[model samples]
Target: MGSFHAMHIETRVTGFIEENCYLVSNPDTQEVVVIDPGDDAADLAARLRGQNFKVVAYLLTHGHVDHISALADLCADFPAPIHIHPADAAWCFTEQNAILGLYPAPRKPDCPLVDATEGMVFELAGASWTVLETPGHTPGCICWKLDAANALFAGDTLFRDSAGRTDLPGGNPRALTQSLRKLAALPDDLRVFSGHGELTTIGREKRENFFMQF
Candidate 1:
């Protein structure tokens, strides 16, 4: 088993929305996985240029354009499968479910796009990630939990003091509420690295997040 001490996480604020893209790595082996590569492909590429980290995969928390804007470009540079919920596949690859006309016709990914489902486990950066289907922000929104590191990559579903907006296409208030509750039920010490804001913890969100009140 890989030790959590060897796992390191780096965050990059990218795109117009300043979305947080995470690079989780195992310093010992220099293996990494990128989450939510929203735009600024050049910057992201530059960060990995001399790092000598072997990118194993790209994980998407959801299909929103802002979280996946750099998909095509990144895949071109580092060939790796993309793990995302099937419900958001179209939104990620094509522009079928895009909202607000914010994205152009996205190019299909050069690498394979795989479905991310609940209970599915995969290894990356010397850590095992378990998928949790926490839909609501979008029909296919999901979260990745690295139990070894006690870290959860919660895309846009749950934020620091607030939750994701349910007014977008396929958004559901009730579903989102349930999702928040599910996340809030996690271990308090679990660190949450969201898509667009500061890092938080399950316990902190439980006590401070208004949406978690449900």
Candidate 2:
């Protein structure tokens, strides 16, 4: 019953980075938000239209290129504000060299960006989500949690059997450990929806994720 009204998170691999673009919507309001419109701007928009959604904003868990390559295109389609963690905002264009130095083209300036903080709560599609500051893969990386749905939009942070690599720029092994600890504390029933890869439950990860102790 609880999952009935829970926000819908749809994933599509678009553009050059192979980043997953998630369309989160409130079934009740038909209002939607796009998370990390990584590359396929047109595809994401088409999908949104097919669902009869009123997209209100584009939220980025971080500013990595693969996660934001199609951000400009998405902003044009939805005409919404672009939100990201302040720490990773600069990465939007700078592509600062770090362990994540290698990958798609260097990031270039394109869209208007906004900063979000931990504990910040916002309403969308008649529901609310808590922003968790879970940085490890990137200094400003985060995960959005919708407690009502027992779901988490974990960017490149925690995965099913493993966690994001800290070998890239702005990554810190110690920080990732701390982030994993925090995620591990969530209820086992919670479903983790990551930026990339298959979705898994917190309980499943806790039991088998070797990188993090459940």
TM-score of each: 0.96, 0.88
List model 2 lDDT by residue over 1-214, tens digit each: 2254567777887755466778877787788888877776677778887888897777788777778776666666667767789988865566352225434543443556667789998776666767999988999998988776678889889877889989877889999999999998988889898878888988899889897773
Name the TM-score of candidate 2.
0.88
For model 1, the stretches where C-alpha displacement exceeds 4 angstroms are 97-102
Give per-residue CA lDDT, model 1, range 60-151, as digits (tens).
99988888888899889988989999988856566564546566656777898888899999877678999999989999999999987789
Q: Can you give the lDDT of residue 214 in candidate 1?
A: 64
Stretches off by above 4 angstroms in model 2 are 1-6, 95-112
Best TM-score goes to which candidate?
1
